[model samples]
Target chain A: MLSRPDFHALIKENRVHSSLYYDERVFQEELENIWYKTWVYVGHVSEVPKKNDYVTKAIGPTPILMVHDRHGNISLLQNKCPHRGNQLCAYQKGNRTSFTCPYHAWTFANSGELVGLAFPDGYEGVDKSEFSLGKVPRIAIYRGLVFGSFAKEGPSLEEHLGDAKRALDQMLDNSPEGELELTAGFLQHRTKANWKFVLENETDGYHPGSVHGSIFQVASSPVPALYKPESLALTRDYGNGHTEFDLRPQWRHVGKPMYWFNTTAEKLPLYTEAMKKAYGEQRSQEIMIDGSPHIMIFPNLFIAEIQMFVIQPVSVNETIQHVTALQFKGAPDFNRRLRQQTMGSVGPAGFLLADDTEMYERNHRGALINNPEWIVLTRGEKRETRDEDGHRIGHSTDEVTQRGIWRHYLKLMTEQA
Target chain B: MIDENEIDPSIAEPVALSPEQELMLRRIEQFLYYEARLQDLHAYDAWESLWTDDAIYWIPANGENPDPETQMSYVYDNRSRIGVRIKQLKTGKRHTQTPRSQLARIISNIEFIAQNGDEFEVRANAFIYEDSLRGETTWAARNEYRLRLVDNKLKLVRKKVVLVNNNKPIYTLSFLV
Candidate 1:
């Protein structure tokens, strides 16, 4: 166990030791105090569309089964069969009215209720009512996304979201029907780095120009009129460790040095015309020509205003990110296709994203050597902080957002449970 | 020029052709082969040029339809979008592309589906293997090609790829499959 003094010192300094990434002790602490205690995003409500549909996932090593009951309420339950401690659901996802454990034929309702048990003669002396499936203490939903917390007491989901709710609203507001549906599949990728490293990259704005320079060069070379930088806005310090970077108009232009997406007038017309047909001229123009922001909900969820990326920490040094593209509940098919194309650039197998994964691996490899002291989070220090919708804004290249995340991280890590 | 009426009917029914039809098909095939070769060689720019000024590249997410307007696709690209992807691939700072995506494509099973005046539709199959820093990834799909012939030259109207496993979880699709 780490001494309280050591923890306080680390927090007061506003930085964490490199060991936090690889130390089993710190990993365990994070599992208990952070992941299990906070409302961690499990999956979108669209994942379990039908009654009795269930999917399995891991929240900091704890296997959980998310099921939609007959009444359509989604519940998170421990994947264990209360009888003899056997795992109940074996598959990744499937539709079944009831789950019968292969070990003992102990049957459970889709709602996690113990419905049947075999060999009544062997259990005559025991009470079957006491062996109900253990439910995740708290399960909540914010804008169609489901989250589960093991701790029975803590902040409410909205309270925990704090100022980050705006980012969530950004995603929900984009849908014409005021609802977003998680597209059919996901892009899953595993990385050899501390999960925090992967999670932090989602909101880090400083790396784009430098790290993706080649991409910018190619995108800008033939179509210099496409790429622009001024239109991008990087916002840091939404309370509770959340940060967001809005890269829209400026980043959409074709030939400027920056991230992916060609922001050319020629290309805009194609999307604009399609959008106008689907959503009417004004609304279609707004949805297509104007780019969306990427939101990083502190600790784990990376909601890209239009898409969703969930980062799951597998081990002290392993992480898995699940990328899901979302469609407006009733948007035109062409718009969905356009969204999918943009999403593909960021998906696990995307040109831009695959490069990011390699960078993470390289960073992890570099961090493992000879005890590197610190990974720099100091960029755009001279820029003034502007307030926008309850967020602190900086230049597109600013690292202040990353600093904000580390600050909240230190606070969470130092607090006593 | 080879007469459309003289062509074999077993492969596909013969349709009326202007004097430029045979030349157009040859040019279109050349463009298709060249694009496939570029992707196989990881030359994104050369591959991107097979499209017309207003063309679309699609990989359907589900269903048998090749339309990009109404269905979700693995990849949906216009010229600008494809340009951005090429830039991303060429960027040295791209962590995922550090080792670069090495690819090989086996394209076959070509057949003409439809044609009207300058616009035509062709179908084919593609098996692509892409390797990067992570590992090797494989994709196989039936493709639908919509081309417009102008002045005896072929330009892409749409290239729709239907992956055998479009609904399954995919790692990433950085390059054209």
Candidate 2:
């Protein structure tokens, strides 16, 4: 285990120690201090919209089963049989009024109540109420999004979200109904990189030109060059480690045809007509012109325009990302275009994300080398300006978001437990 | 904006092939072998020329779904996008291709499912082995091809790849798999 002084020495104002990327001790500490104590996104209400619907998820190293019970309430329960610590829910997802433990025929109700146990006379004094599934310490829902935390006392979900709520609303409000639901399935993938690398790559605007250079070059259509100085985009560091790159402000008023090549003018008639009908002309036009930005709600959840990323840390060096593409229920044409655009960019065999696999793997390999003690993150520091909410704002092609991540990371890591 | 009807509906009803049709099937099998070889050798130009102007290359996700519009796919490239992908593979700074993946694959179980005019619907099973600096991975899939004879040459109209483990998480599928 690293001592307090050793951890302090690893992180500095302009650089972070390379060991943070590959150290097993650091990984464990991160799960305990960060993931366990913070509100982690589990799933959306739309995932389990009806009674008995459930989805199995993980928070750091612990598996959690989120289910909608018969009384129309959602509960996050530890996926373990209280009798012998055996796993109860063996499936990823299904509709079940009661889950029977395959080990000993111990059954639990969908609402997490202990309903039955085989050969009950053998365990006479055990109280069924005390032996029910263990619920997470704290659970809350903001809009349709669900989150759970292990810490008994801390900031509420809204308090933790803070100014980042605006970004979440922007995505949901794009739907004329002011709501959205996840599609049928998700793209679950594992990569050879730390979870933080995934978060940093998602919010970092400086690397797109180099990392995905081939994608823009061969796209054969008008795609925004994120690295260009004239792009006029900016990174906003909403306090509490939540950050985003704001592209909407840059493209909303431009009036140029900025739609992705796949979502062409010819395909927009039906969807545009539907949007106009639902939200009227002005709001529909505004939604159409604005470009969606990537928003990271520190540690676990990442919300892009049409897709959502759920980060699960497997170890110090490996992470699993769950990619869910959101679909508007009412608009079939728009949903079709949205699915195509998302798949082309971030799907498993996508034009953009496939290019990132090599870079992430190489980064982890380099981190294992002991020679370089620090990785610099000092880009665009001097020109950064503070907003009214005290968030640091820098140009689109700057490392401002990375700095913001480290700033909050240091605070959480160094605080006395 | 493609009509769903244009898609080759899966033909479960197998028909007996005449001697001429069998010869055509043999030639189509040869064409598939050559196409796979070109991709393995990184012969981008030769591979690009095998497709017609309106060709479609698709890889469905979460199992095979008939509709590409409603369900997401791993790859949904039209003719122009296919050209762009070829150009991307040849670029000097493609990090994924810096130490490119070495691939070898086997195509088997060839069956002529259906035919319409000059276009023939064929089905086959494939297993691709990819080796790179990161690691080695084997991908198995069902391949459905829509081949048309244009000017005495077999030009690809559409190719749909259905992976066996489409519902599970996968690593980088950057190559032509």
Candidate 3:
């Protein structure tokens, strides 16, 4: 087994070793340290809005069932029956008042309550209270986004989020009702690469100019040429592996309302009026001008401007990314456009993400070789500055975001060991 | 067969098409074959040439509902967006299709589901194979095509491809598939 000092050597001050990407022993260590010992984004409440709604999910290979019970409380229960360790919920998602194991028919309430056993005579002196579904210990929600941590002790969700909370607040405030919905179905993008590549690419301000050059040339996207080194945009690394591509700095130049959607406030009079009434004209105008955030919360969640991505690490060399368009509760007129924009940008067949997937897969292949022993993370370190909030800020095309991710990864991986 | 005399009135027998109608059917099948050939060869420009001005291309998501306005789909493009797709593919920098995948597909079980004057609805089973740097991937789908005859040419109005792997996660589908 690799020791704490070995981890420090592998993940250096500014460069990470190639073995970190494909080493089986390192992968197992990550599952123990990074995946199990951190706060991971589970899902959203809007995904299971009604009582009796349940969705099966996983946290580092541990099966979890998030269900809205009879009392409308969402509980994170293990999808396994306490008896014989059989998996209780089989379906990905559904509506159910209670769950019954298909193997032995042991029934339990959707709220992690052990209502009854199949046949009481099968075992004597078996305490029904001892057999309730196992709870995931730590569950928290901030602005309707649900998160669960496998570790019982650590930073609370609010503390772990820190300044990164601004990203979620920006998205929620983008809605006139100060609420966001994620009812839109996912566009799953399964790629052959390390899961960290997804998070690294999420806040990557450098690759857009080169990796997605073709789409920029063909279409008039808001991101066209906005990712260059001289662009006014800033790549920020908030602590805890949380990072952001804060385009608001550059967008301040235009200051046009709803420019992110390539539409004017005049085109969306309904949304304009709703926003004006909701937060008054001045703040609404600012919200419209600033637009949505493109940021990544460490471990799994990425709020990609208009869409949300959940990165699932299947193995050392495989990953599954699920993306869904963000839907506002009261913004009915504008939700359709968000869906269209999401389909156009991020899915498997997306004009931009398809090329990105190619780059990531190519990185995975190159990481397997022994030629280059290290992956450099020293692009803009010399000139990088700090914001008032202590965020490490770099020019648009810099390695500040990636360095931040690695720094946080090293901390989590080594501290636990 | 003694049709009218021996058959019961409740039974509806299939009628033979006129020679002119048969010829039109043959032409329609040939047009479908030509379209598929263009896609396999990665002749994006020519493949796009088969579409009319008001083309609608949609690939619905996991559910039975194929509505683009409500449910999320893999690809939903109007005529203008379709033009954008073709433009991106031809930009010579799209790495997903950098060298272009060697594609071959087979289409069978063709049937005309509906027809209204010059417009017709056609459905067929499709099996497509693509090979690239990532190796081979086979895709199976039911192709739903809406075609219209304009100036004696069969032009595509809409297309909906429901893939067998629609519900599960798959790799990059950058090509015509």
Question: Largest DockQ belongs to which candidate?
Answer: 2
Query: Which tens-of-lDDT digit does each residue in A189-216 have in candidate 3?
Result: 8888888787899988889888899988
Q: Model 2: which residue pairs collide?
A: none
Among these predicted structures, which one has the highest lDDT?
Answer: 3
Stretches of model 2 off by over 4 angstroms after superposition: A1-5, A220-225, A256-267, A273-281, B1-18, B64-67, B112-119
* Residues B1-177 of candidate 2: C-alpha lDDT, one tens digit per residue: 121123354647678998978999999999999988987877889999999999999988765664676666778899987887788888866677777789999999889877788999998999999998778999999999999999989988999998888766678787886
* Model 1 residue A233 CA deviation in Å: 1.9
Interface RMSD of 1: 11.1
- Ranked candidates, highest lDDT first: 3, 2, 1
DockQ of each: 0.18, 0.38, 0.37
Ranking by DockQ: 2, 3, 1
Tens-digit per-residue lDDT, A7-117, candidate 1: 444443234556666667878778877887888888878877888777776686677888888667898889998878987776667777788989989998888777787
Model 1, stretches more than 4 Å misplaced?
Answer: A1-16, A218-232, A246-292, A382-392, B1-95, B101-177
lDDT of each: 0.68, 0.80, 0.85
Task: State which candidate has the highest TM-score.
Answer: 3
Q: After superposing candidate 3, which stretches have Cα over 4 Å from the reference?
A: A1-5, A61-63, B1-24
